[model samples]
Target: MNLISKLILGGLITASLHANAMIIRHDVSDGKYIQQAADYPAIFPLKDDGKTKNCVGTLLTPQWAITAAHCTILLEPDSQLEIAGNKAKVHSIHLPPEYGYMKAIKNEQGKIIDIEDKVKDASFDIALLRLSHPLKGVQTFPLLEQKVNVNQTIEVMGWGDFGNGLEGVSRKERVNDRQLRVAHNKIDAINGNYLIFNFDAPDSKNALPLEGINGPGDSGSPALIKLPNGYFVAGISSGGDYPGVQTHKREGKYGWQEYYININAMTAWIAETMALSITKN
Candidate 1:
């Protein structure tokens, strides 16, 4: 796990409670994203080798995709993700330009000693990936026009981890890692730069009692808000405060306090980047 808000659920394979953990699909979305349940071919699963790393992305257009800035920074930049079983090469990676990759200091054992303690820029994690080839027939989502409000119910999704001790163990036998899952989260805070929410269950009596949470393998996943138009991308998974089983297991906070890069705040950058002729996947 690259400790600066573990991107949760990317292909970094097994993360140490601090990196890309997937959505904890209790009722499912921290545990699911924009569309509830695993809807194939729409929300493309960005995957690598089953052993290495993976991230989810939304196709804004056949030629472009939206994901976290950390996707380019944390994971291998030269590596390609499998989309629809075809190679989606990164032609260009566009961060805010002001943002730089802030890496965690790890120990000799490769465990993250601390999180992103020195990063000053909050507008650092959202990014756009210009694809090598255009995807066809996949539905693209719009960005939420207004800022999300506190207490708003948002649908979240990821292809990250699930099951056991909050560990990045596999659900569905871990064989279907690319299987997209669903879960829900509520907006708890709205700062100008970030959107935050917790994964603890809103109702204890509800079925799927497992609190919906996000963890390794889910980096770059989208947080969606439904409006009259349709489901819109509101936030991109960025850094987060996670209590790995070694520490937070007994803390009673089942869901991590996930802080996502506010997509609405960066729409200008996204639009500007998309229009640019730059390419790098």
Candidate 2:
């Protein structure tokens, strides 16, 4: 099926299934180790009212943030899109170089015209957040031009609530808690515009089903893969599916994860944008 259909079906499957084990709450007394990764400094919580809404972003540059455009636009109403940090502000938004308007075929039926001219490159599914002020004490992670290989292990950290959906509480104690959660996974597939990863379920050795990993709150969180020298942003947490276990399937049969818009694919766009921003400033 298409990306949209996969997302909708995935959501339905996740909602109906409750056979998965509840995530255990570990001790909060110890320092959050997940928050210590290089990527965590740039990961910020995106909030709507006083509640922890979604993951915001870190300032890769004074003007740019690496995030999924689908999560930033489709999931967030225009008015509610605000950055959360020591200081929060919103400025202009930028998409990649090829992010101009495009048409989409709806199944075998008619075409869906530009629903919002603002979102043209949903296929790439990546967006850059421009902040009103330069983020203090934040550093951009290096971008990799080469493709990451399958079976290569990577670490992902995010403020995504540990439980199930929006109503689930965060794994951390405080809403703003910079506490990070680290999970390991390997690359499963490399599509033209996305990358798939296979990770184990919470406390389970078996791999999660297709399109299941970090849930909704992890929408824009970066997947960090280790390199010989350091780490690179491999993928963004896009979406997942969690169907219940059945006799026909194994115990961990229903956990899978799919991430759209791998950062390496947009290296040129990222370099170009930074260069332009530097010149303008």
The worst-scoring run of ten residues by lDDT in candidate 1 lies at 10-19
Write the residue-wise lDDT of candidate 1 on 1-281 in tens digits: 34443333222323422223444543443322433333434455455445434556776677777887655544434546556545667766667866655454567986545444333464567778777778665567767778678877776665534442234343223423444556666777887678877766545443243335455556677888877867888888765655353333221135557778787788888877776665321
List residue ranges in candidate 2 displaced over 4 A.
Answer: 5-39, 74-85, 97-121, 164-179, 200-212, 241-253, 277-281
Scored by CA lDDT, what does every candidate get? Answer: 0.58, 0.49
Candidate 2, residues 1-281: lDDT per residue as tens digits?
44433452333233211111112113222233244434455555554434343544544654466676544433322323333334645555566655553222243553232233343444565666666666565556555557777776666655423443213332222234434566555677787766775444445554422113454455566777667886667776554444232212111122444464577777777687767766786
Model 1, residue 57: what's the lDDT? 75
lDDT of 1 at 92: 67
Candidate 1: segments with Cα more than 4 A from true spot? 1-42, 51-53, 74-79, 102-123, 164-178, 202-211, 242-255, 278-281
| Model 2 deviation from native, Cα RMSD in Å | 8.7
